[model samples]
Target: MSKISVLIVTYNYGRFLAECIDSVMAQDCGEELEILVVDDGSTDDTPKVVANFPQVNYIRQEHRGVSAARNTALKRATGDYLAFLDADDYWKPEKLRLQMAYLKEHPECKIVFTAYENFLESSVSAQEEWVKRCCQFAEHDIACLPTALFHRSILNQCGLFSEDLERGEDSEWTYQIWLQKIPRAYMEEKLYLRRLHGKNLTGSGAKQCKEQRKQFQKDIVHKSIRAVRRNNMEKNGISVLIPAWNAQKFIVECIESVKKQKFTELPVEIIVVDDGSEDDTAELAKQAGAVVCKAEHRGAAASRNTAITMAQYSWLFFLDADDRLTEGAFEALYAPIQKDGSLSAVFSYARDFYDLPGRSTNAGEEGKVRTYSGCLPGCSLIRKEVFRKVGPFDLQLKTGETVAWQLKFRNTGLPSCRIEYVTLERRIHENNTGRRMRGQEQMDYARILREHLRQKKKGE
Candidate 1:
């Protein structure tokens, strides 16, 4: 059996077939390689072209989609490693050599992909190289078939391409590969060459690819809903509410910390209100098992109120999208409530982490937790009845709603006390709205305090 199987699926690309096959023949790697060309009822000079190369194994089938053609080749492949080459694209001489070496050295990585250079059909020279992003899950990063060389075992886990999807079958299959957690390595060098030709634009595959991408996105959303439901089937107590705005970068880790909370006494449900985020914050939160709702651009107080209404349980714990709950946050908050049923609301200490030069207001040193008089709302767990009695947050305040509401709720004489135990880690980054509170935000804060003093004056 051959060590590597190079697969090429083509319908009617006779002009590019010989050149694509020649690139495989030109590979300088010292391994036994076999080239398989599967033709899907091409009326062109495809058979005559394959006849020119006696070494190439050519299979002729009825007009099936690219997915079906690739699946056919995948099942019949006899090699240990498989490399797919699109009919119009070819690879560099060192493409197979470098990928094989990397895979052998790193057994933990199941698949490896190389960067590709794109060229116009009229010109042979590639304009530039396609690059990978530094981020783990970049929105625009696309995985192409020619860039990857995979082991035969990956097919067992990821499965073959969808035979129905004509255009984006490869994309859908690649997405499944990522979902299966098959480790992959990306090479920075552009070892593959792609041709940008107009001939393939009018094909059936091209039309199906656009529609298939949307369908694949819907599948991901539905899958996320199912996953969240299955994982969070526990008796719930506290409803963790987060008001987020364009927090795509930090929301994943934030929700992950909440999901990792293993509370024996109080099971929690997370609810996130994405207040007009232009990014994927809502989707990421939902994917992380949080019940998500997207609404118009609103202040934090209003957003939190929306989540409070959607909340399923009694105890409500408010948190920011950029911050994280400590390891035993839910348990610590629940412990006090479990001890004292008369307590309407319980507040805990918070560990503030600062990324800027200055430290948090209460936190003395960087990377440490300290007791602050006015802790963030995330440090408090309040009974839903208490919030209802105190009334929803005042929309007049631009910022400092925590302090303003604390003053207002104090008049109601509800039993509330602060615990010594820290329950939340407040991340103070550049994105912190607290740090950027100025102009209208500052004015609104001053007005709340002024109104509080007026009410105190009347009592005195």
Candidate 2:
């Protein structure tokens, strides 16, 4: 048997298949390494392209899903270790050599993954912060599929890929491995380059990809609910609270995004608080089939308070009407709470999605503040119990309300954990509250700083 079996699953990726194969063939690992390419019935010239690579063990099968293709390769693979690469993605020449060295040195580790750079048309960029935020490199479960390498022996125990899942099969498989408490290692190096062209799976199959994301989120939420139940905690259904005011244009998108979360195992009670919108914000929210609550044109601080009062779940996710949740946001948010009984709340990073020039396309870029005062409300997920004890957003303060609350939490010395995952997307548009109330917001922010100083003085 070979030391490592490289499995490449392809479907209509003739354009990039050659480069992927070449990269694998260039690996310098001295041990026996076999390349297995499973062609998933690509109508394109994928078969012809693979035919040129005589060394590759090519197998053509009917159009099965990627999971099935991968499984076929897995069954045929006769190696001690297994590494999968998508046809549109390629590894560095030393990827196998370096990873194998690391794994051999750390034999206790059953799985390992590395960071990767995204190759777009004529330009290369790091994966979006949102993607990185959802999963940290330090943890294998948080790593993306393209960057992972696993031992074949572990597959026997964890089982093969779920053929039923067309998308997010990697996530499901990784999550299962994590649940087994298998030792995992991280290289922290970019070993693979994932192409993000328009014709790629995520871009070409946008709708299907989206549905898969929704299912993934549901799985995470279900797992969290089970964890909570096992601890004998009160089964508080999750309350997804959105604070909206004159957000007619984006309300539907926001609600639809919430409905897509994969955490279907837990009952989700969505509450959209319409803070007296002159526009049809409430109407739009209701049209989207969300439970709407109306309050006199109050700021977001008041809006969140009203929503919490009506919230059935003890945990609260305060999302803006224009923001959205990424694929595993709910799972990431609930994981910390389930692991640590003392954690009062958790916050993740958020990125701007308005497509402004020079703006970071990666998620959670803006929310990566070194200090507590830099944190924003829309980017956070809070526990209702902590919110109740800390008190609701200060209605008196219109601007920097979130910062003010975070400051209070910091002062009280409560455990406020920051999971570097990007769970929320803050849509930046003309109607953003910051742009709308610029002057007043700045003034309120000044007052908040002054109050913080005064409190510090008294404590001193």
Candidate 3:
């Protein structure tokens, strides 16, 4: 048996998986270690991402929740000592080395865990300081799963995770073991890192926390959805298409926001087209419960063309990796298209959340930010058949490709609507490509409009 077997239960943590694995593998004290990753029916490119790591023992199963996934990993683990890590969290190099030493020294101690740090991902408020916060002495007196290392004998005594819960499985399992009166040790040094972002199970109130209440009045827009089974939703479906390239920083919040949309009556599926990101974009997108497709490093328009083929639903809505949809984004768009077969598409007003950026807290006051209305491609939801007529985006044009496609839609003279409800959010960061292409946007958009008018005259 190996000295320690690390059980990592992952649903869709593509972007963080490699770092988590590397953290354990770097344990220099050198006891034999086996790392097992259990992927619970991830629809993203997890299989491909895991293949990049040959050292890990990877097992995949159907779309069970994290509880079942943990139970699956527990059964396959072979080491005498066991440690559990969430895929989105990782350990410091000495984490395994220190915990193992503690377990070895205290024969009476059945479990040992170290203090940890929290790596907060996205912060909206400007006043919030994001320096890494480590779990201090006695901070986590009760053990967190990510920091805990236990003997295999403890498993024989307490049993595996309860497979019933969708959220608090780890807590429930640890609470059960805590009742057994098993001797456990806690180290003061921070040896693990928990990455907290808006997508976390407790996605409420991260924005309005005490960090900002002292400085400025807070406006929070928090909306979330439970990942219920698809069978429970309506037969009419809405598919979200996101084009990603080097979007590891923003994709999680983007996908999580989509999951929380207010259209509970319609089935929603997110499709992320990885536009040849050299970074962890594809893996991260998949881990965030998006279906991922790989494509060559083309421009944004071409990536959308690739996503068109992979979409499973009847209606398609395009989203940029850095942008997000609000809770009721689909409310105005879906029914109009469903009721009027002739309507080619329905578009919504977009709030450009510039001040707070992508991870905005107060949805109500977000309107104070700059908002854009009329024919924004990212805010529009289109019928799939409309694409067959408009054809794929112009390959020759590097920018303003969406404007060119919009021109084609105008050429068809089909019915469409502009709704007053704020359906989507356009995030403005330093890297926003549109911010750099202002002059080109005007020129290309004018050219496309002229071309459409010429086509209209020719048809008449």
Writing each residue's lDDT as its tens digit, candidate 1 over 292-396 gives 766667678878876765565667889889887777877777777778888878888777776566645433343444445434767888887566457778776
Off by over 4 Å in 3: 1-236, 355-364, 438-443
Score residue 54 of candidate 3 by CA lDDT. 91
Quick one: how many clashes does candidate 2 have? 13
The lDDT ranking, best first, is: 1, 2, 3
lDDT of 3 at 375: 60
**Which pairs of residues clash in candidate 1, taking residues 3 or more apart in a chain or in different chains?**
none
Instruction: Please give the CA lDDT of all the candidate structures.
Output: 0.74, 0.73, 0.70
Ten-residue region with minimum lDDT total, candidate 3? 219-228
- Number of the predicted model whose lDDT against the real structure is largest: 1
lDDT of 3 by residue, 1-460 (tens): 2478899888767877887788777887578888899999887767777788898899999988888888888899998888889888888888877767656654767776665777666552222333222122113223566688888998877798766544445544554454454655555467888776555522243333333332211211010011112222112478798988888989998999888777876788888878888999988988899877656677788678767654556678888898777777787777676677677788778777663445553544554577776466567888765775677777656577877787788777778887778777777776777666777667777777787788888999
Highest TM-score: give the candidate number. Answer: 2
Instruction: Tell me each candidate's TM-score.
Output: 0.48, 0.50, 0.46
> Model 3 misses residue 283 by how many Å?
1.4
Model 2: residues with Cα > 4 Å off, grouped in runs: 122-141, 201-209, 224-460
Residue 372, model 2: lDDT of 28
Q: Candidate 2's residue-wise lDDT over 279-358, tens digit each?
A: 99988887787877655676788677667655656577777887777778788777887889787778887666663556
